[model samples]
Every structure is written in C-alpha cells, then in structure tokens.
Target: GKTQNIYALNYNDKDNDIKISLGLLDTKHNWSGWISPVNGKGTKSDTPNKRWNFNIQKSVDLTNKDEMVFGLQYTKDSMHKTEHNLVNGELNKQSKGNTRSYGLYIQNDHKFDNKWSILSGIRYDNWKVYDSWMQLDKDKSKTIYYPARSDSSFSPKIALQYKIDDESNLFTSWGKAFAAPTLQKMFSGSASSASYTEANPNLNPQTVKTVEIGYKKKFGESTILGVTYYHNDINDLLYTRKTGLGKITYTVNGSTYTKDKQRVENAGTATTNGIELDLNHKINDQWSMFANYMYQQSKIDKCSTNGAAEGKIMTYVPKHVFNLGVDYSAGKWNSELVGSYQSKMYAQDNNSDTAKGVYTAYDPYFVVDFNLTYSMDKNSSISFAVNNLFDKEYYSYNLCEGRNYMLTVDYNF
Candidate 1:
C-alpha cells in the first residue's frame, strides 16, 4: 500500500484596470509504498512558495475612434523549502529567493472605417532581484551560497495591427526581450559539473529579438481562421568551460594557500522560426469543431562552450504540434472530445554520447480527452471530463513528467 499528498494555491483579485491581488501557496507532500529492498516507510516533505502582486492599467481617448492605454505592474515573491528522504533520514536544504519588477507601457488604437483599423503599442520594464544565490570555493571545502548583488535591466516591446475588412485582419510586429541569469549560476561560487570550472559573477543577461506576422478571418457566422508566423534571434547565452584544479598545500589558521584556475565565458547565439494556424467551425447548434497546428525550427548560430548543443538544434523544441477537438450540446446533455499531437524533438544539445543517442527524438503521440454534462435546471448544470483518454506516453519540454489522465466534475448552484 502507498499514500500520496498534494499542494495547492488560491488567489483573489479585485478592482478594474488598476487591480490588486493576493494569493497563498503551500505544499504538504508524503509518499509511502512497499517494495523489495527498500524500507516500506513513507517520506514527507513540506514547503511553501508565495507571492502578492498589484497591477494598474488605464487608457486615454485621443480622438473619437482612437485611444491610448498605459499600464504598470508590481510583484513581491518569496519561497521557503526543504527536502528529506525518509528511509535514510537524509536532510537536504531550506533556502529561498525573492524578486520585484515594475513596468510602463503605452498603446494606441485608430479606426479608419468599419472594415479598417490600426493599432500599435510600446512597453518598457525595469526588474530587480534580491537574495540571489552563487557558488564559491572557500577553504579546501567547496560550498554553495547566495551572494549579495542587485541587478537591473531595461527591455522594450512594439507591435502594429491592421484590419483588412469585417471578416479579416492582418498584422505584424517586432520586439525585444531579456532574461537575467540565476543567482546560483553567478554566486554559488562553486562548480559540481565538469562543464563549468568556476562561476562568473559578471555574467550578462540573455537577449532576444522577435518578429511576427499574423492574420485572422471570419467566414459566415459559424467559422473562423487564424494564422501567424514568427522568428526570433537570441544572443549572449551563458557558456561554461572547465579549468584545471592544480594540487596545492597550505596552513589554514596561520598560512594556508590554495591555487586553482577557473574557466568561464558567455558564448551562445541562436535563431528560431515558426508558423501557427487555428480553425474553428460551428456545424450546427448542437455540434462544433476546433483544430490547431504549430511548426517550429531552431538552430545554433554561435557556440562559445564545448557542448553537444553547439552548432546543432536547440534542445527540447519540437518542429511540429497539433490539436483537434469537437463539442456537442443537445437539450439537457453536452459532450466533448479532444486530441493533441507533437512531432519528435531532440533531447540533447550536442549530437554525441547520449544514453538514448544524440538525436533522441520522442515518438509522435496523440491524446484524446472527453467530457459530458447534464443540466439540473435552466440555471444550473453538472459536468465531468476525462483528460488524456488513451493515456498516451509523451513528454513536453524534456524533463517534465509524461502523460496522465484526469477526471473532473463541476457543479453549479
């Protein structure tokens, strides 16, 4: 016999454009099972991660058919956690991380006619972090810890949209995005893997430039179509290297000196392009169907470190994805069926030595989900849904758990 546990979150938001939100997140996890060579006792782990956020958005009208909008957002986040193994009573760690960010954005919408309109917007963000982690080599013993460092960055986004007619619209836009490296990567001050000899405290943020074009069309009163094409170029990816740790001896209390050489660099660049399409049709008042397709490709344009990913495809990003679903509603009964598929994707960055081979492509797989509902009255209904009907075997984003089915029931009173 075995026991399992769960953790959850609940949030509440109030107000209009300028909003306030609060939430609580907690975990109470325990597992117990009986097996051959291991202790049948259970394991327990308790942790909590929480955050409170506030956002503000407002729009000003410049003309009868034109308006400009602006927004500001802020968040405060914190986490506390620990890990332990029940069989051997191995104590792990209890640490936390926190961050805050603020942003300003503006946009304008103009209408030229019933079938023609244009929209554009620009945004800026300033982000900051506290309690960042870093690894270091102190004394002869290696230790990992957080370093005191405050970093900030400015990023921008721009977009434009044009309407072709009442039934169709075409649009395109370009923007820039950025992400700062984790604190552990910088200050942990120690290296466990052979890829990095030492942590780089001066690591820069990763940057990306994205361009996209899209169109949306409506046919008759029961069908709609949407298509989009996007491309992205990224730069300044962090690269790690190995450095020799030479033999040395020294006295600790009075005179102890050790010597080591660390290797570090920031050499990473890449480009990705993709296309997306979606279609929805209402065959009648009792039946409807929806379909979606996505195709993407990513390649390494530059490499600064010795890794399988250099000059090869980015890890985990698949080249194709698709989904289809149908829904039926008649009188007091309703039902739905949905399916999704994804093409094979690589599991490693380098094209070499992998337990399953360098180009370990996962098999193409699909999942079917179903749902049913019954109306208790004109104002109330009850419903049940089962996700992953066939329980297909697949993984998204490499390290995540594979597929599973879920049964859900909802009631309205």
Candidate 2:
C-alpha cells in the first residue's frame, strides 16, 4: 500500500519572460506478507520519502532569428526504511539517507536561413550524498555507515535541422549525460531466511554518450513516416551479483541456515545501437492506423568481475520489437485495436539461463488488446477494454498475467 501528497506553486512574469516554480512531495509505502507458509513466519516493512524542488528560468529575445534562455534548479530528497520480523518481534533491517543537487543551464536557438536551424545547450550539476547508514540482523547485529560523497559534471548537447521542404526535414543530435546511484542501491540492505544483500557504499556514477539521426516526412496530407538511428556508449553500469554464501540464524529459534548473499557493484561497460521506423496513415474520416518497429543490439564491452559477461548481450534487452494499432471513430462510438511483439531476451548477464516455461525465464511473446467507448451524452461515457486477448503464456521473472477485462465509467459536471 502507498499514499502520497503533492503541492506546487508557479509564478510567471509576462513582460520579463521569467518563470519560477516550487514543489513539494511526501510519500509513504508499507508492505506486510508471510515469509514462509509452512513456518508461519511473516515480515513487515515501511518506507517514507520526502522531496522538494525549486526552479527559475528566463528567456531573452535577442533578435527575430535568435533566442537565448537560462535556468537554475535545486532539489533535496530524503528517505527512511525499516523492516521487522513478526514472529520474533525484532527489527530485521533499517536504512536512512539524504541527497541534494544544484544545477544551472543555458541554451540558445538560432536560425541561419530558411532551410537551416540549430539548437545548443550546456548544463552543470553538483550532487551530494550524506548521512547514509544501514543496519542488518541475521546471525548477529551489524551496522554500517557510508562516507559522504559529492561529484560535479558538465553536459552539453547540440542539434541541427535541415528543411528539405515544407513537408519533410532531417535532424541530428548528440549529447553526453551522467546519472548518480540511487539511495537504495548505495545504502540499503536486506536479509531473509534464504537470501541476503549488502549495501555498497563505494559505487560511482554512470555516464553515457549518445548520438542520433532522424528524418521525417509527410505524404499527401494523410500519411506521415519517420526513421531514426541511435547509438549509445555507457560506462560504469551497475548490476547485482552473487558474492558468496553465508549462514542466517533464526531469532525465534537458535537454528542456523545457509543462504545466498549478493551485492551491487559497478559491473562493466556497454554499448547499444538501434534503429526505429514508424508510420501513421489516415484511410478515411473514421479510420486511422499506426505502426512502429525497432531493432536494437546491446552488448557488454567489458566486465571487471566476470569474464563470461564480456561480449554477451545485455540482460532483458530484446533484439526486435514491433507495435501496430488501428483506431476507428464514427459519431458517438470510438474503438481501437493494438498488437505488440518482442523477441526473446536473456535473464542473466552471462546468457546462460536457458530453461523456458519456468520461473526466472525470459520468453518471446505476442499479444493483442482492444478497447471500445460509447459516449452516452455530452458529459458521460463508458469504456470496455480487453487485454491479452489470446491468453499468451510467457515468463518475465514470474508468470505473466493472462487475458483480463476492464470496464470504466466517466462523468463530468
């Protein structure tokens, strides 16, 4: 179960072309479940999170063909978590952490001529993590505190567009970005009867560089086509790996049990290349259709810890994906039908997990869905939807949901 609250304020000055915004969020999530059905053991967890942000931006019109903008942003976030064992009435695990960030950015948009235009931006950000700790109780009680860490990065991006005609254009973009590790990945740990994980405090941030090129065109005022190719180079990717095996002692009884232990780490470097194609067409006033396809190849270039993972395809990334949909509308009725398909994907970094029709297996699947809505009046409507129309059976770590139905009603005053 979860609950959340959000509040926001915005101020706009038309004459100065300035905008200012502030936002706050509070959230609470709790979970309780039986750990073992045979032993009647249970566990409960609680997590609370809070965040606030402020942003200000200003735009300047230098000339009819050129414009510039500048912006500043700041954010603060905090999280706390606690887990307890019901049978023993004792704390099993606990974690708390906070993060802060500051950012500044500048952008310029310019048009050299009627057929050429360019957009460029640069941003600098500083991120800080502090006051992070984790505690775990298994065979014994232990507590670990993470050292404070801070880092700064600069990202830059540029895009150029060439107009072939009024109905078509070509565009290309390149950018570099950075992402810091989440609080859960760096300061959270959990223990159970069969498995456990340890927090990693020395992990580094990940970085990626991307380049993309695309073309879009309109045909006969009823159809549109788009194609794009993109490449990404990533460094310091994070993944969880089995570290070793350890013994866990049950507090209710002094019995000890062996379990697998895992930890998160900066695993390796990776690269991805992909191409996408999409088309949209309008057959008549009451019918429209859309289709899209993507082909991607993602591979791990190097692995510092496991040699088998190098040169293998990344886990959970399918090589091919496709989607098609048709929509119809006539007077007070509207309906849509969509189909999706994906190739098989691996479940392990080494590409060694091959059993199908079982738990923790990845399998190829294709499914179709449909929805229809009838407008009863100007302010009221009802909708019916059917998902997984064919009841396809597949596994994505666990068993996928089969065919399902939903009915929705909407009314407005």
Candidate that scores best on TM-score: 2
- Give the per-residue lDDT of model 1 (tens digit) for 66-125: 988787766655544333445676543334455566667777888877655666666665
lDDT of 2 by residue, 140-259 (tens): 347777788898889998999999999999999999887888777776665544346667777778888999999999998899999999999988887665533354444322334556
Enumerate residue pairs that collide in model 2: none
- TM-score for all predictions? 0.70, 0.82
lDDT of 2: 0.84
* lDDT score of residue 78 within candidate 2: 87
Off by over 4 Å in 2: 1-25, 35-39, 51-60, 73-75, 138-141, 190-197, 242-260, 329-335, 369-391, 402-413
Model 1 off-target regions past 4 Å?
1-20, 28-48, 60-62, 81-95, 112-116, 132-145, 179-205, 238-267, 330-334, 351-363, 373-382, 395-413
**TM-score of structure candidate 2:** 0.82
lDDT of 1 at 92: 37
